[model samples]
Target: MSLEAPVVRGVELADDRTPRPVTASETVYEGLIWDVRRDTVDLGSGTVRRDFVEHTGAVAIVAVRDTPGVEGASQVALIRQYRHPIGATEWEIPAGLLDKEGEPPLAAAQRELAEEVDLTARTWNVLADFHPSPGAMSEAIRVYLARDLAEVAEADRHTREAEEAEMTAAWVDLDEAFAAVLAGRIGNATAVIGILAARGAKEAGWVTLRDPDAPWPAHPAHR
Candidate 1:
């Protein structure tokens, strides 16, 4: 059987979900946070088996504030934490998994910001959304741009433990963060995407941003 190429109609680029017939599926591994699954699928051409991680999705925040005395400049909040997989300390924005059942993405971002950095924001916008590695993982992340910042009250702060207890927070100029991303200093997927997307949004006068509670169809937990 010959497979015909799909027709293209417009210049606007977008991603669509393509569902294939899963002939067989099974949970290969179940961990504390995520699970691995192996599946046999029919891709029109033939049947193939693959293993992938099943994720609960997550949310990230690019908390921003205008630079004092620096016209048209902004600063972003960053956190440095030790990532065991990479065996190195990496810089990243405030983020957390969508493990809580029925909680919205905006609320998760808000909670992460306060928990990770002890900060809160009055304004929020959907900066960007993406799947870091679709081939091997079903993780989708939404990065939010948060402004009008204020510190969370000490009494209401979440207690940090494990790796989080050793995490450090800092405020860096957005431009500097962008430069760091370019220079290979900041390697976290969420941080790189958020910094670059935030810079682009800022250059466009933030007219491209969406509402904080905008529809996120890509996240399985939300959808």
Candidate 2:
């Protein structure tokens, strides 16, 4: 017996923003960066109560530069920062929360790149966007592919504090970073997603990327 591929049907491969009715909602706990919210949602079949993190969304950067003397290869900046929740220092790309009021995603990404890594990029493109954990959090993240890099001037650099004060940075080959993700050496969700997506975009001749200012309708804050 032989089986054929299943018939494909859809307008396009994209996620829809369908919000369920919330009968009741309240903040269960408010933290520094996010809050836990409990809501009674009408699921059509039945109503269910659930608690999830109310995030402000964030942005990440895959700052890449051509490897000197290497053909068709690049190096991406990675930072090591201690995460209290995980109790471990993980390798991550420069990223930050969108806590500032009325900040665009691209602007946030640029700010994070400079603050976290002391670098700037002349070219930027949207590599990918995703919800880190849609089931338990409303944290939407947009990762950008940043190239044509340069260091931020000393006088203009922002002062670091807390975990960022002790953070360390390294420039690694893009392929090596992707391998680290596959090998589980790198566990930061945003880092893993950004590296893999950057590699995929590069493989596709960077045509798969969107403009840096592309509309992001899936972000909770944006919606």
Candidate 3:
């Protein structure tokens, strides 16, 4: 199906489920990373106050390459980095926040690819986009498929520090990565979703893959 159909269909479906207007809202806390806000929603029959996190969305990349060893095998770039919230150095695809004002999602992906792994890709496509958690946060992540990779010069590499200082990058077989996701060894939301999505897309011959700069309505800043 054409990509526009999904967009239009979503809007049409939304017309029937539109929620009551927000009569009032206030920021309870403002921080460097995210903000907490209370929204007074009118539910027609009643009204309620709910607190949620206001966040800037993020992006991830599934950087893949063809390896000569196996007939149907492929390799993907993954990073092992410490996540403070989880208190673990989980394996994940290269990803970063979309915090820059007016920056296109594709550009943020490109910048993240170069900054995280010091690599660049000649080809890029939208692999998958999803909300990690919708109940309490307004964040989402768009994953991209990046191929034809090349390493950047040492002098131009992004310097690492803090949590990223101990990070390690590796090239793992795509099948192994997906297996890890199924086995629950890799718990990072983006990595698990992106790996499985990439496998499915590859099986389907990537026919449904969208352009790197595809429209993402879930990302409020992008719209």
Q: What is the lDDT of residue 212 in candidate 2?
A: 94
Best by lDDT: 1
lDDT of 2 by residue, 1-223 (tens): 3378676697588786889999999999999878999999999999999999998899999999999999999999999999998799999999999989999889999999999999999999999889999999988999999999999999999899987899999999999999999999999999999999999988999989998998888786664
Q: Each prediction's Cα RMSD?
A: 3.1, 2.5, 5.5
Q: Give the TM-score comparing model 2 with the true structure, all chains together.
A: 0.94
Candidate 1 on 117-186: residue-level lDDT in tens?
Answer: 9999999999999999999999999999999999988899999999999999999999999999999999
* Model 1 whole-model lDDT (C-alpha atoms): 0.94
TM-score of each: 0.94, 0.94, 0.89
Query: Which runs in model 2 stand beyond 4 Å of their true positions?
Result: 1-11
Residue 97 in model 3: lDDT = 93
Model 2 gets an lDDT of 0.92
Q: Is candidate 2 or candidate 3 better by TM-score?
A: 2
The TM-score of candidate 1 is 0.94
Clashing pairs in 1: none
Residue 150, model 2: Cα distance from true site in angstroms: 1.1
4 Cα displacement, candidate 3 (Å): 32
Stretch of 10 with least lDDT, candidate 3: 8-17
The CA lDDT at 198 in model 2 is 90
Ranking by TM-score: 2, 1, 3
